[model samples]
Target chain A: MDVSQELADYAAKHTTQVLERSQPVQVDMGLLAAFDNTPIDPSEYSSDLDAHLLQLTLTSTQALISALFALPTTPSAEHGPVIRPPVPSTILPREKPLPKPKEPTKWERFAQAKGISHKKRDKKEWDEERQEWVARWGRDGKNKQKEEEWATPVKAGMEADQDPAATARAERKARTAKNEKQHRSNLAQAAASSSASSRRTAQQARAADLERSMLVSKSATASMGKFDKSIEGEPKSRGVKRKFDENVPKAGWKGEKEGLLGVLKSVESGLGRKEKRKGETKEGEVVVRKAVRYHDREERLKAGRGGAGGGRGRGGARGRGRK
Target chain B: MRPLTDEETKAVFEKLANFIGKNLVHLIDRDEDDAYCFRLHKDRVYYLPLSMLHLATSIARPNLVSVGTCFGKFSKSGKFKLGVTSLDWLAKYAKYKVWIKPAGELPFLYGNHVVKAHLGRITEDTPEHQGVVVYNMADVPLGFGVTARSTLDTRKLDPMGIIVFHQADVGEFLRDEDTMF
Candidate 1:
C-alpha cells in the first residue's frame, strides 16, 4: 500500500513541464563551423553598376544622336504643324462648320415624291359639293360637325356683340330659342300635370297666335287698301260682288283654299255688313290654320342662298292706276 | 359631325377590349353610352361608351402616368391607340420582381443587363423568361425587365452574368441616350 501511494505521488509529481534556469549560456567556436564575418569585395557590385551606366550611355548616345541627326527631316520648331492635306479644317483649328446639308439629289427627290406622305392625316378638306368639311379620319368626326353647326352659331352670338344689327339678330335668335323651349317645357309640364290641361292650353296658344296674326294682317291690308272711314259702320250693296284686289296686304296673303283666307273672307264680309260679328270671333275657337307651304325643302334652301332671287314685290304698286 | 360607322365602332370596341379586357362592365352606362367622347384636332369629336380616362383617374389616384391622361393615345389618323400607359400602371401589381442592390443601381438604370450577383433578391416563385419589374433596393420601381435566370438560383449564380434584360429603365429619364452606358 505504501509503495502504491509513493508510485501515485511520483506519477503526479513527474510532469513534462520544464524548469526555468536563469544561468547564462556559453557558445564554443570549435563545436560548430565558424561563419566568416568579413565583407566581400565590391568588385561585382562596381562592375554591375559600370555595366548599367555603359548601357544607359550607349542607348542615350544612339537615341540622342539619331534624334539630332534626323531633326531636319522630321517636324521641328520651324515646321508649323502636321499639315494633313486630305482633311479639311476641323473644330480643333476653329474652321467653319462642315458644309450645310446638301440638297437632295434628283433620284432622292423622286424617291421622296414617290414616298408616302403623313401630311394627309392633318389635312382638312372642304367638300364644296357636300357643303361641309371632310376630315381624314372616320368621315370627319360627327362631334366636330355638330360643334361646327351648333357651337359655331353660338360663337357668332359672341362674335358680333358690338354690331347692333348682328347683336339684334343674335338676340332675336336667342329669344326665339327661349320661347320655343319655354313653350315646349310648359307643354311638357302641363301634360305631366294632366293630359286635358295640356291639350286645352295648346289649343289656346294656337288660337291666340292665329287671332293676333289675322288682326295684324287686317290692319296692314286696311292701311294699304282704299279703306273709306265714312262707310266704317255701313253695309255695302248686297248684289255687288267684291273684286279680288292684289294690292291688298299681299304680304301674308296665300291662296283662298288654304291659310286664313276663308276666315278672313268671312270676317271681311261681317265688317262690310255692319252687323254685330259673332261667327269666327269666339274666344275659345280651335281656329286651326293650315297654309299650303309647298316646295322641296332642298330647293327652297338652295333658292334662298347667295342672298338673291326671291319674290320681293310685297310693297306692291298700290293699284298705280287708282293712285 | 360624322357618326361612327358600324365598322369603326366595332374597331374601337375591340381596341378597348384589348386594352382593358372589356371587363369594366361596371363603367358602362347603357343610357349614357356616350363616354368615349374624343375631341379631335380638327374640332371634331364624338361620344361612345367607356370613359376610360375618367375610370383610370378614379382608380389610379395621383399615380397617373403621363399625368392627366385617360389611358389612350390617338394615331395620326385620329384612331384611338390604347394600352401603352396601362402596361406601366399594371406592372406595379405584377408578381415577378427583381430588387437590385444599391451598388448595381447606376448600371441597372443605364439599361445594363442586370447581373444576378448584383441583385439583392428575387421574389420567390418567379418564373424564368417572364416579364418583371426592376426595382431598386429602396423598393422603388426603376422600369421593366425580362427575367433571364430562374428565381431559385438567384443566390448561387454564375458571376458577372446577366440576370434580366433591362428592357426599359429610369435612365431614359435620368440622362440622355448618348451619354448613358
Candidate 2:
C-alpha cells in the first residue's frame, strides 16, 4: 500500500525471476553436438528458441519470488515500529587536543622569515666568531684528545700515532722552499730566453726592412728605364720629321740615277780613264751605235712584255693570287 | 602599335587586376589622394586606382601571346571563355614569365632596374577601410611587367629610381673586372 511496501514487493518479484532463470538446463551434449554439426539457419530456429527462453524465464521468476519471500525482514531504523532493545553506541571518545607550538624569538623569526634584509656585520666580529668555532674543532683540539688517550705510552714494540700537524707543517715548509727555488731559476731562464728572442726578432725585422727597401729601389730603377723608353716612343711631329729627313735622300738625285751613271762611266773607260780612247774607228763606232740601238730596243721590248704579262696575270688571277 | 579599344582594354585590365590581386601579398597604400585603400590581413595595404588597372592591362596584353599557348586565346568575337585559370600555374607554364617582389629590397640581381621610389605613408589621405596592399610597377622585380603607381606622389620625378636593363646590370654593378692590386 505504501511506497516502501511497493518497492519491497517489486524487488522480491524481480529477485525470484532472476533466481528461477539461473537454473541449469538439462542439455544433451550429444544431441547439441549433432545440432551444431547440422548448423540450422539462425532465423529458422529463432522463434522456437524464443518460446523456450520465455518459458524458462517465467519458471525462474517464480522460483526467485519464493526464495526471497523465505528470508526474514529486519525492522527499519527510522520507523522504530518494532523495537527489541536499545543498542550501545560504537563510536570512540574524542582524542586529547594536540600541544600548541612554541612561539619563535625575534632573532629566530627574523632568520626564518623569507627575503628579509639584515645589516652587514663587521668583518672583525665575524672573524672572532669564526676563530672561536675553529678552536673548538681545530686539529690542535683533536690532537690533544689523542695525546690524553695515549698518555700511558705504548708498551715495547707498539708504534705511536704521529702528530699530523707537525708532519704536515714540515712537509709544507720543504715544498714551499723547493717551489721558491725553482721559481727563481725559471724566472732567470725565461728572462734570458726572452732577451735572446727579442734580439733575434729585431735582427729579422731589420733584414726584412732592408730587403723591402732594396726591392723598392730595384723596381724604381726598372720603372725609370721603362719611363725613358716610353718617352722616346711617344708621338712627336718634330722628332719624326728630323728622323725622316736623315733617312731619306734628295728627291731629284734618285738612287737609280747615281748607280747607273757610276756604272756607265766606269764601263766607258778603263777603270782610271774618264775620257774616250783616241783610236776611235768610224766603222767600229757605227757598228757599236747600231748594236746599242738594237740592245736598247730589245730591253724596252722585254720590259714592256714583262709589264703586259704581269698586268694580264694579275687581272686573271685577282683573288686567287694570294698564295 | 594602335591603341586598344576601350571595351577590350577594360576587359584585359580587369583580368590582370584580378590575377595580381589574388596572387600578390598586398602592401600598404602610401598615397594621400586615393579613394579606397584595402588592408590585407597581413600588415600591408593595397590601393586600387583605375590608372593602375589600365597600366596592368597594357603590360599584360603583350604577354598574352605567351599566355595563349597555355590558356587558349580570347575569342575575337565576344565569347564566354576564361583565360588562364591559375596565375601560379601560368607562371610555371610560361617560359618567359618574370617573378617580382612588389615591395622591400629588390634582389641584388635586379640592380639599377629595380626601382626604389618611396610611395607616401598610410594616413588620413588614404583611408584603408577594406584591407588591401598597395604596390607599384617600380616595386615589381626585374623582368616583371610594369604597372602604374596608384598614388599621385610618384606621378612626377623619383631620383632614387634605378632601372636595370638586363641581368648583366647586376654583374656590372659588382664589377667582376680583374685588378692587379
Candidate 3:
C-alpha cells in the first residue's frame, strides 16, 4: 500500500481501538486483580502501540478541525467604516465657553487674591463704625446690614469743619478730671475720719485704764481690811510685835500707813539709813546693800502714798464708776 | 572567712559547671570524673570563663595576696608574653584556687567523667586544688572586652557551651574588693 493509505489504515485501526477502550466496559475481576498486583512486563506489549496511539490522536484532531471548518459561516453585516455619534453642538457651545467659570464670584476672587493691605484698606471704614469697622464690608450680609443700621454717617464737610475727635477727647478729659477730683475728695475725707477715730480710740483707752486702776484700788482696800482683822486676832506676844512691824511699813510694801505716827516713823527711818550709808564710804558690799535698801524704802514710801490716795478715792469713785 | 556551707558550695559548683558546659566548644565529656575540663574557642565565652574567675577571685579571695597572670600577650608584641610556665609560676605565687559543683542531682558516672575531662583540659597546667585555670580565649582575656566588642558590632558570639543567665546577685558577688587586692 502507498504511505498515505497505510497511514490512513493505521489511524483508522488505532482510533477504533481507542474508542473501544474509552467506552465503559465490564472488567474480568481475576485478570484485573492479576494486572493490578503484578508489575507490567514491558516486552510483552507491542512498541507499535505508541505509534498507533499517536496516529489515532492526530487523526481525531484533524477530523475535529475538518468538521469545524466544514460547518456554516454567517457573514457579518458590513456597516461601512465605524463612526462615533456626533456630539450635540448645543451640549458644548463654541462661543459661550461657560463664561470662564465666572472668575469665581467677586467674594471668592477677592479671597483668592493675596497680599492685600487689610489694615490700610479698613482705616476709613473703621473711623465710620469705630467698633464694627471690620464687619462693614467682609462680614456676613446680615451682620453687615446690622452694622450699617447702627453706623452713624459723618458728612465730609462737617467732619472737616469740626476737629473730628476734639469733642470725644474733651469729654474723656473732663470725665477723667472729674473722677480724679472725686477720688482726691474721698481720700481726704477718709484720712480725716480715720484720724478722728484714732484720737477717740486713744481717749477711750485712757478712760478704761483709769477705770481699771480705780477698781484695783478698791479691791486693795478690801484686802487691807482683812489684813487688819487678822493682825488683831493673833495672840498678844505674837500680835504686839506683828502689829508694830505692820504699822512700820515693810520694805517694798504697796499699801497705806493710816496714822500720822506711822508716816513720821517711816520718813525718819528712810532719812536715817540714807545719811548713814552715804557717810560710811565702803566698797561694793556697803554700796550695793545701801542702794538696795534705798530702793526698797523709796518703793515702800511711794506705795504708801499711792495707797493712801487710792483708799480715799475708792469710796467716792465706787458708786459713780459702776456703769 | 567561713567555708561555704555544703548547699552553697553545691550551688556555686552547679552554676560553674553549667557555664562551662555551655561555653566550651570541644567538650570531650561532662559530669564524668570528679574533675571536668572544657576546651574553649577563641570567642567571647572563652574570655568569659577566665574573666568570671578573675572577677570572682578579685571579689571573693580572702587575702590581698592574690595575683592575676594572663598566660598570653595582652598585645601581639612578644614583650607581653609570659610563657605558660611563667603563668604556672604566677598561679602558684597567687595560690589561686578553683572548684566546681554541678547543679540539680548528679547525672551518670559517664557524665561526671566527661565533665572532669573537660575541666582537666582547661586546668591542665595549674594544680586543680591550688590555682584557677579557666578556659578562655587567649585573644580576649576578659569576657567584658568580647561582650563589648560583640555589642558594638551587633553580633552574637554563638558560643558553644551552655549559657547561664546569671542572677543580679551574682553581680553583687563579683564586685571588686579593692581593699582585698
lDDT of 2 by residue, A222-308 (tens): 564345434333332222331212111245224423432343333323422311222222222555656788998888667656754
Candidate order, TM-score descending: 1, 2, 3
TM-score of chain B of 2: 0.20
For every candidate in turn, the CA RMSD to the true structure comes to: 49.2, 42.5, 44.9
Clashing pairs in 1: A141-B2, A142-B1, A142-B2, A143-B45, A144-B44, A144-B45, A145-B1, B36-B48, B53-B70
Position B131, candidate 1: lDDT:
61
Residues forming the 10-long window of minimal summed lDDT in candidate 2 chain A: A29-38
- Reference contacts preserved by each model: 0.00, 0.00, 0.00
Candidate 2 is scored at a TM of 0.12
Fnat for model 1 comes to 0.00
Q: Pick the winner on TM-score between candidates 1 and 3.
A: 1
B2-95: candidate 1 lDDT, tens digit per residue: 2233334344444433222223232232234443332111222223223443453354323532322233444567575432233354343555
TM-score of each: 0.23, 0.12, 0.12
* Residue ranges of candidate 1 with Cα displaced over 4 Å: A1-323, B1-88, B153-156, B174-181
TM-score, cand. 1: 0.23
lDDT of 1 by residue, A1-323 (tens): 35998887888787323212233122122231112223333674477876654544454444434434433343557775332222222223546777645444444556689994434344566666688767733445432443344233344445554444445557656766887886676557545445554456666789777766654454576464247343353322223564432312234223311322333334335443432222223345643321223435555566655434441243223333344
lDDT of 3 by residue, B16-131 (tens): 32223222222212222321211111210111122333343434324423233222222223122222322232232222222223321122111221133122123222211112
The per-model DockQ list reads 0.01, 0.01, 0.01
lDDT string, candidate 3, A1-323, tens digits: 45998898888877533322242232222222111122333553366677655645554545444544554555557863433322333232376444322223333445569644343433324434355534333334222343335344576556545543555557656766887886676666555555775565556789777766654554477564345433333332212331122211343122321222233344445545644644454333456666799998888667656743333356537745864
